[model samples]
Target chain A: MLRRLIARWQGIVLALIGIVATVWLALTDQLSLYIHPGTSWFAIVMALIGAVLVIAAFALTPLEDDHQVASDASQPGPAVHLHEHDPTAPRSVGSGTIRAALAAAIIVGASLALLVLPPATLTSAAAAQRSINSETSTLDQDATALVGGDTSSFTVKDWAVLLGQSPDADFFAGRSIDLVGFVSSSPDDPDNVFYVTRFVVTHCAIDAQPVGVPVYLPGWAERFEPDQWVTASGAIVPNPGSSSAEPLLLTPDEISVTDQPEQPYVY
Target chain B: MSPPPAPLRPAPPKPSTRPRAAVGLSLGVALVLLFVAIRVLAPEAVGDVLSNSVQDFFTLSISVVIESLPFVFLGILLSIGVQVWLPDGFLLRHLPRNRVARRVTVSLLGVLLPVCECGNVPLARGLILRGLTVGESMTFLLAAPILNPVTIITTYQAFGWSDGILVSRILGGFVIANLIGWIYSRHPSPMSLLTPKFQASCAHAHDEVRASRTRRSVAMFDKETSAMLPALFVGSAVAGLIQVAVSRDVLVTLGQNPVLSVFALMALAFVVAICSNVDAFFILAFGSTFMPGAIVAFLVFGPMIDVKMLALMRTTFTAKTLVQLTVIVGLASAALGLAVNALA
Candidate 1:
């Protein structure tokens, strides 16, 4: 009887672990950091469905033939390693027992890893590893989708795309821009020059690409911190040293720290 | 089921008297206690050491599962719906069987299935079970992920609809999937290619074979969930780990070398395993750095084969078959990518 109960509930226990991991993500409001806002509902729905499946398994075990559930409980092997779909194919020689244990181990390891870790957005180090374009003054208009219709709605990406499209460096001289992103900087940059970066995601966090622009807060540069969320209101100007380069320079008039936005990553 | 190798089919065993329950219960209890103790006592130390890259890795891994599971669910729902709800013979009767006509029709039929590469495995398994020939089904499996509306429009948009990438992707992907299907159709011992369990279970009634409508579907949902979820996590964890350890910037340096770049980007594509519908956005970041051919290869090779596809494919195919699929896909994408590189 004890053997019958274990075989039947093992799948449910695994499913329960999946549910727990998702719930942990949800409770911490960290799902947003992992996926786009539009698709977060699916995770919730999957959690609910996963719960239903676990519950159904619990109910079905008593009615099911004990031999039947035990077979399934033990069959996670070939299903993963060599799914013998053809009836005419030869019988599996490997132990189903071993495969089942492997499946259990993988699922448990993955779930625990996520549940135990702290939730975080990509770091400045990764932003560097991604090597996002820092100079956004001049951009290739033809290359990007052109998100904003006019100068007032310009994002960090729009400014980056403006590099090649501009007739010349003077084109952005007096353009006033307002933008919000987490503060980031190059590894060796001084206090005055730091980047304001936002991740642009086409699908999910896995594909999010960082788009950032260099901001020069001359007098107040030393007061800021990396990865600090802030709003910068500034006028665009060409960089003094690299006048011939296309990267636009931002000279901020007012800068203030802000709470991380509800939808922190751009879609 | 059928004495092992049954991922989905749950049939009666002869029964064992060993107390498997005690092992399971003890393990569960131990796992909970250990996790609680470690998480409560040592979280800060773990966080200080593992928070940055490790956290990103965890996020990437979980997000991959989060993104793909919905499509997997929908695919399973649709595939099993056809199996359980459709009166027998309905599918085989409606689907074309003329060699050329059937392959072409089914190949083009992929436009309707929106699921990407990771989620298409279960659906393809269903199609085969419904009597579609290996050739026809393989064509659909390969083409469906790329030819669908979501992938097409996204690719177009990602390229900013310039440089003929949209047309080239369509033309190139269409040709590759069809050719592979055509080639496989020539030598094919379809039965031997498949695992024996699937072949046997295909004839027999498994657990959900007789339940009522709701029960049947729910049972199927339970069965497929058990079968596929473990593989999804395994694949995602592998993919996430690779992404964290290898930086995208490192891959960017190889883009300067044209010949090596294609292979580099191809390997990157296989490792990243981003969905075809959204890979264009990811690859677009490489636009300024990588050549056109490398870009095309990344797009074309990735959707057809990747870490997720490899992990998922093992559930149904032999190692030999997977190797063949990989070599054929790699060579074809390389040829296409090089052709585009030469043109550029």
Candidate 2:
């Protein structure tokens, strides 16, 4: 009877652990950081239902006897056979207990390390990258503002908003901003010209879309390779005789190669 | 006198029959009570935290489901084809008689079929029923999600050609799948806990359908879809919850140390449980801190084991088999990850 009770309690304990983990994750707001925004609610609802079912199944079932027999039968054949010859077989449980304790300690230690340490360094690195991009883009936006006319269309909502919207503004009236991104081939021009491209992220990087503005400057092609990280400072200018063809254009005044930021992918 | 003798025999007891409606009503009542208790006792502090999380959860879940919708549709159609057009014993005939060859072939086939992790379970079961060996079936089960077309495209987009992340993922997946198969073949006893029911049902279902020539093929498709869809939804939900609840920062933080980082990322893979089709994008988003090798492990290991996979594993294998397989897959994945990192 005691063994049966123990077995039943173990099942319940597993279920409880699962439930607590799920609820804790939900309460932490970390869930959205990993998945798409559209399905998270349905996922939570279904998880709740599944957890309830699992817990109920454990609590209601009087199948401990069957479970024990199955477990015993399923024990690795060599181990069981060896156990049959040794009266000291039951003593092995102490070793199993020790192993379990060790595993628990490791799990706890890791969780603490994750919660407190790495985020600080990673966030700082990401912030440093963002600051560099912002500074360069601010210069370009100022240049564009001088060339075009006014700066009503280029309000910064966030880093992402600023990056995606700047390329569409009318040259000379557009914000003179510094832009930092990886070099990709310019879609409009092929000859020694490129676009400074960054990802426009809607949710996670999965839905990230590429956004860029044309960059034309002397010797710009020689300095930056495709996928090389760079920050370009330039004024937004209208392409000669291509007002209707090109949306917005930039002539870079200065450019510098920077170290690949920790968070290489902006989105 | 003869009639009296006949009447002397006692009548047999009637079998008791209970209405299904009664059972359902009681179940409904119990569920309602449980929900009430949870709602009443739920903490207010947690409520604020959950609001944004709930929103984020819905968003992510919808996006992933939408992205994988095409693959899911194609996979279901393929499953239907396996059910209807493929003749019985077709897979068995194609499968190699030699154990090692069979394992390799099945793993290759797993790469060919472009299904996500959730879809692999049914496909593996289907193949097993068609006479694939246990090791081969398991190989297919592990390899298919990792090697699919969608994953390949996403990996290319993520790491690009410069680092050779895409090629590494494919080759690494193939090697790991085979290694797992080889290990399991050498130690075949761990798999003995898989019940005969897994083998019995497919043949049984096929026989029943064969006997009924008048039944439309659509009927079988519908039946299988209906049975599998609920499990699929449940699995998707579990994956979604994990994604929402666990922070990316948390996962990245865990990836700091070399060995523990690999295990941590693998566990995160199991928890976040993103579909293999779209997981490449997520892994790529993890930033440059995540090693190419660790990302590969996450991609390879996640589809084979996760919350939803666990639920499915329960249906076919005993608890013991599931535990053994989980340990073996986890260890193999970690070792492969270390190897790739070292080579890089």
Candidate 3:
């Protein structure tokens, strides 16, 4: 009885793990970090239904009857006419017992790890590795603040996009700005500028693209370590960034260390 | 009215309740303790070194599973419904007997059933039981994941509504699916390509369902879950690790060459099995980096094959067949991508 009970718990355990993970992410309002805004609600609904169905299986098909059902499901009579269900008929489980157990261990182990650990957001090192700013075009459609009007409203992502649109840095000579991001040293930067980095996620953290604006902190860029969140206020200068065409650099008059935002990733 | 068959047994059933509970609780405790030790002993040493890329990967993996799980269940439910309610007569009656007509009918049927590659496997099995030919069913399996309407609109939007991408994806998927299906029709015994057990038991699905609805559904769910889910976790973990660890700077360098770019993005598509519904958004980042043809290849090939898809496919197909599908899809995508690059 105990062996049978252990074996039957396999599907149930997987279902429960899924349910727990989905519920935790949703309740914490962290589901947005993992999927697109357009599909986040849809995922939540799907997860709810999936969890319910898995739970329902416990009652709908009792543990003792699971193997019996599996036997029935796997039996395709060689006979010309379909015979009614027969337990006596030959059945095949194949090498399923060991394989299902292994799969369950890995899946359940991963789920539990997520629950126990404090959630980690993407870091600056990955931003450097992925080396993608191609999202400047698709990551933001909100930064259409009339070219000269309230340049202060732009974040690092908006500034990155706006700066790329114009040919000469002379276009935005002096625009006031307030921005927040983590610091990562720009590759091949002779001037030693620090890029205020923000990872923009379009659809889940997997597709996150790094975008940043150069901050001319000169001696101060070295004061902070990588991935440390900071906020700065300054005026935008028509200066070329480390890479790409005429990127707007920030001449932050005031800068301070800050805590990470409630949502670290921008949609 | 023969005597009840003896339960199949080899070893005696040992009492496992205490051992099972001990195993579960201790595993949990061990994991918690390991993390807690790291947090306490050298919190500063640990704080920055703990790469959130792994965490973020897990988050994405779990999210992908949860997001798609509903549809998988729905597919299972649909497959079960067909078995219990309408396995015969309904599908066989509507499908044509003519060879070319059947292949075309099912390939176009890809539009109605908008399942991604992962979710479509069970549904394809169900369709086969409903009497689709191997050629017809395979076409649905390959094409539905790539050329579905949801994928269409997303690809359109992902390219910011560039008609070139939209047109090429449909063309590439249709041409490949039809050609593959046609080729499959010539085989002496196409059923030989499927896994041995599935080939044996598939026909009995209807009779089994009729035996008891609960037993059948439970059985079906158990089979589906066991066959696919473990590989899913392993595939996600491996794919995520490689993506995070490997620098994409080479990807950028390769993107500049039209020929290399086609191969590169196709490779990326295979490794990163982003769902077709949302793959466009992923590819949009590469739009500025890679050529139009390369991006097109990424879209065309990604949903059609990937590490996750391979793991899922392992449940149904032989390794030799999997390799053939990969080569066919890869060459087709590359040819289409390169042709576009050369012409336009």
Candidate 4:
């Protein structure tokens, strides 16, 4: 009875967990943590549809004797049916037990991950694994247009693109810049240089690529640890060190710890 | 004329099943409330207990589920519609009579139903049960993700006819899908390609006729969820684990090599398990570092086969068949990528 019940309801249970979690995230304005804001409406709308179907399913299918009624009413014959629901005639009792156990595990795992766990942005570990500033082509913009545009509202991504395209230090030498991002140490010059990084999400967090602008600061490790959010403002200058690959780096005049913003990624 | 009159027994009170619906509804409501309560009451500090990597594993896995869940629901709902609401043989009757032409028409069905690759699994399962040949269903599954409007538009937007990346992906996906379908169409027993359990499902689904459409739809929702969600969760977890374990530097380092870059990006595609609609933009991040061929390979290979896609497909196809499908698709995509690179 328990096996049949689980086999029948696991999906609906999972659907419920996902719907509740999604709706909650939407309500709290935290959906962007996982998916892009552009897709949030679609996710929310689908969740709502799934919720209605689930409720309708619950209201229509009686809890008790559903297997007997469903089988008899749907198809009258020898009880061959959906494989997951055929526990009574399993080829082996062990296999049936195993299937049931696996189903239960999925239910429990999904519930815990989706419901009980708190929502979070991708951490520094992901950033480190993906390697900050390695893939910034998505941040690419026309360099000439960037030089002529208003510079004060530019993001770290905007600056990173400029640094990549027009790295003629003369262009950035006198330009004061301000940016907010998590800190990740440079691979080549870990001791003196760290990057101010943020993930650029195209569709969802799964596709998020880390983009950062290098900041040259000696003894930076003593004050700021990796993954700590910071707001740094300074003038861009030619790289004084020979270790880092970047041609120009941000030499901050004012740098301080800051809170992680509501939307940690730039789309 | 009975030899003896038997005493009547109380019929066990019939168990009052009239209230069962109410009970079920109440339980569902209670479950939702319980989930919400747990979510609200869970400690924020609980996240801090785990190390960053462990935390990221959960975060990444959860995000995949959260991102793909709705599309999965949409697929199942559509599956229900196809099986229950549509008249019998509605889809099959409209297709071309010739086998190859039928398969071609089937592959183009993606233009109408633009569900992502993960969602296509259930829909394909539905099509097979609805009298679509196994080979044709396979074609639909593979081609739908690439040929769909959203994916094509996104690829266009990302590359804009540059270096033939967009053209290569579309043509590659279409040709590979058709080739697989044609190869499998000649099999003496194509049903052997499916898992025993799914075969059993196909067998019984054909005989079902007496139930009301509503009941059958509900039952299908239950059965499909039972089959699909477990696989989806497991697939998501695996995708997440691979991302954390595999270093992108290893792959990006090979981006400069014409031949190796094709394989490297294909490997990246297998691990990332990103949705097809947005993968072009995702791969655009590597546009500068990787050769156009590598980008093309990533675009072509990713939507059809990935860790998550394999897991979901496992629900229907046998392990041996999946291995074959992956190899063939991988080779075809690599060939397309290398050709584009040589020309460039």
Candidate 5:
């Protein structure tokens, strides 16, 4: 019994250290950046449960003598019986020493890396912000161009920025901006209207979410398939208190089929 | 007999002479104390680092464990129930007799079990002990994470039905699993890697329960769970650390360089060791930058070959076998990815 207990002692100690370290780190707020901000509380709870399970398992394991006898009785072969009581057999000693050293090295290395490395700089975030700001400014200058006047002042980014800033922004409620995305058919609206969809990816394409602006182009139905990526220059118009889908709609001036851009999704 | 002269032999000491349990308990306590002391006495500069690290560790641990709790619990319960309730002859009776038919059936069945890659290890182990052939067990291990309902639903939702990515992932996973299983069956030497001692232990546990008419199976379940859970926690902790510490920029940069990208992602998959349940999301995010084929390779190869899986694999197979399996899975996944890219 004693021998069996000793054999499992190392595992038990390691597990406890792991549990304590995890809990301590979480409670001290170090774990916040990696996990979803919203899920921090839940994470703590689960950690506690996991820790308890681990500790309980460690405590419940049978003593070494009983374990050894049980094992010996179960397997009669010499192969199974060799050095049964030697917990520090050469194979175990070498492997254990190496594994422990490697684990310590990894933990230390990771800690140093995390400490030295800065948080990922959001390169796209800055660009997106700049583009939106620029577009918004242009749209403001082109406010008068909506009355059948030609305006080169407004840029695509400004219009997007304006639309995003106020889905109810008054000027764009009846004006148009150029947009590009894949065609997605709406089941309810069987007219020539389709959603021009693009994915906005943040970190990677994996977390990409679909964003679509509704468009009503006269010949759009015949021009594009559901998955075909296309670009359309259009006029923005407000929907008259219709469905909850989207308040504003687009009226395309010209539609053209386009190839999917590299990095099609943005987070 | 009493008249015979007594030999001058020394009798072996009784088992009571060894203070085994006490020594073990003290050693365990001493190690814990030693670690705690070292943690407490960390240098001031490193103290801040350790504190931050601990916090990060806790947070990541919690998030991952909670995120996976539902699936983990369900998988364990199902596994336990399968062990206790499923008849001994269930697989043998239901599984097809022909090799080809068995392969197909096993592959199809693998899709229905919604276990993450880590969870699949235990399930695979259980299936093997329950008398499933190596080929069937291998097929299940490879296909379970890829073909499960959760992965399918997630994929459908991610890509929609616009292109055939969803169908392609399924078809690709199915074909690859079966092909690997068939090849494995042809050369069954890998099956010998399962240590006889481990098999005997598993069999003994099973036999004990079978011998008892009462609810003694709970004890066996507890024993197995206890044995497996510590390794699981440690392995996962290591994986989490790698995920946080490694930069994606490095991976992306490496991924830009031709064939190196494929090997890089495969290596990254082994290192980052994300759960199979949500790895596809990460893979999709890296689209276009890395070859679609390479990304597919990452997805297929990663779940089966991560650090945690390797650790678990060590428990079952010899070192030689583990290395061979790793190479085989790596090559197979890459080939499949290339094939898909060419055909698509």
Candidate 6:
């Protein structure tokens, strides 16, 4: 029965699991947590189409297919020709059973991962693993465009680019910045400084690149844990400390914990 | 949609089957509702049991799965259309009789169907079921991702003919795909290169089972997903785990060395497993640090093979075949990268 179920119903079960998860994510407005917002429609639409197909498959498929699958599953040789009904054939029952069990395990595992777990944004661990600020393409913007523009709407990625392009303190002398993102410690000065980090996703979380704006706050770890979402308002100042490598850092006038935004990753 | 594969009998499905269909429908609806309920009401703290990195690993893995699931469905739908609806031998009859010309034609099919590599696996399986030779299907599988219109346009948008990145990717992908096709076409028993179960599936696909197109399609969907999704989940998990385990700094530091940079980026490409359509933009962040050749290698090698691609392909190809495919594609991509670097 397990083998038969694995052969005939595993795909439908898995597809349904995926379809339900995707649609729920879409309904909840959290699909962007895993992928770019631009592609959410495509994912949701395809999922709906898949859901219909799964239902249609369930409703329209003849019982013969099920019976054929069961009979085929019972015949146990691994070779392609084993379906040709050779009673004397040596059956590889052990391997076939193992394969079926593995398939069953995959079905269970996929359900638990997709259906049971709460949706999440990538953490500081991902930021550190991909290494903060190592990626430049998504961060490659016209820093010059921000020179005289309103700086209130600038994201951490914008400031990161501006920091890279306009290194002089005068460019940022009077600009006050307000940014919101998860907290991650500066690699150089973990205690005194932490970065306001957001993943810049070009397509999906798989291609996400960590971008952060360093903030100078001594003993910040005592107040805020890594990956804690926070809102910070500050001035961009030249790094005040001698030990840090970053030329510029955000010296915040006010910082407090906040809820993670509806969309955490900046596309 | 076209005529069903076989229409000789065309007998209407019996009324007796309607009750069974009702049962199947209820079962399916019940399963879907159960999944939704589980997703909605499952304890939020269940995920917190895992540490941050572990949670991130699942997030990344789930992300890959969510991103690719739709494409995989689209692929399977297309596969079903190709196998059950399209007229038999319609695709094969038009191809050139000359083997090399046939492969050249096959590789360019991707330009028409722009689904990325993940989608290509099921479509390739469909083509094989529809009587395309395994070699030609292999050619389509490798060539389609890079040769597709979306990938080309994205590459163009990202690089804009700089350092010959766009031109090299297109030409290199074309050459490498045909090279694989040509080599595999000469195999003594090409069927041996496929997994036994997949080979059996091919044989069964040819058996001319008589059923309504709807029935056949659903049946095909069941079989295809059973084969494809397990591999996809496992592949996504491995990809996520590697992303959490490996340090990006180790790879980025090698970006300055022209030779090591090529291998390093290739390794990165293997692990990152981003879709081919957007990878040009993804890698552009590293464009300043890495040589053009390394980027070229990445563009060429990644769509054709990666942790995810390998798992998807493993459904259809044998372990030995995959190993050979990896080594050959790896070497060819490396050589292409090195040659481009030299020219630059």
Q: What DockQ, between 0 and 1, does each candidate earn?
A: 0.26, 0.04, 0.26, 0.45, 0.05, 0.55
Can you list the residue pairs that collide in candidate 6?
A137-B285
Score residue A175 of candidate 1 by CA lDDT.
69
For TM-score, candidate 1 versus 3, the one ahead is 3
lDDT tens readout by residue for model 6, A111-187: 88889999998989888877787764335577777677778788888877778777889988887889999999887
Model number 6 iRMSD? 5.5
Q: Pick the candidate with the highest TM-score.
A: 6
lDDT ranking from best candidate downward: 6, 4, 1, 3, 5, 2
Best by lDDT: 6
Please give, for residues B1-344, the per-residue lDDT of candidate 1 as tens digits.
11112223334422421233334334455555554454444364455566567777777887787777767766776777766788877877877777777777777766877777766887777777777766667788888888899898888877855656777778888888888788888864875555444443343333345456655555555555655677778888899888888877667789867788899899999988998988887787556677888888998899999998888777666677789989998999999888888887
lDDT of each: 0.67, 0.51, 0.65, 0.84, 0.53, 0.85
Query: Backbone clash tally for model 4?
Result: 0
Q: Write the per-residue lDDT of candidate 2 for residues A118-220, one digit (tens) a residue.
A: 1111111222222222223322223333335433433222222343346444434534667677676553354545666654443342333344556765345
**In DockQ terms, which candidate is top?**
6
Q: Sort by DockQ, best first: what order?
A: 6, 4, 1, 3, 5, 2
Model 3 chain B is weakest, by summed lDDT over 10 consecutive residues, at B1-10
Worst 10-residue lDDT window for candidate 4 chain B reads B1-10
Give me the runs in candidate 3 sitting further than 4 Å from their true place.
A1-9, A62-101, A132-150, A219-222, A238-247, B1-49, B56-60, B85-87, B160-163, B210-215
Prediction 5: B-chain TM-score: 0.76
- Which runs of model 6 end up more than 4 angstroms from their true locations? A62-73, A76-80, A83-91, B1-15
Which regions in candidate 2 have their CA more than 4 angstroms from the true location? A1-267, B1-50, B57-76, B186-192, B195-206, B209-223
Candidate 3's residue-wise lDDT over A22-95, tens digit each? Answer: 55667777666566566667666766665555544543433224333343333232431222333323334443
Clashes of each: 15, 39, 1, 0, 29, 1
User: What order do candidates take by TM-score, descending?
Assistant: 6, 4, 3, 1, 5, 2
True contacts kept of each: 0.28, 0.01, 0.24, 0.60, 0.04, 0.72
Q: Which runs in model 5 stand beyond 4 Å of their true positions?
A: A1-3, A9-267, B1-76, B188-191, B195-197, B203-206, B210-227, B237-246, B254-261
Give the TM-score of each candidate: 0.78, 0.51, 0.82, 0.93, 0.57, 0.95
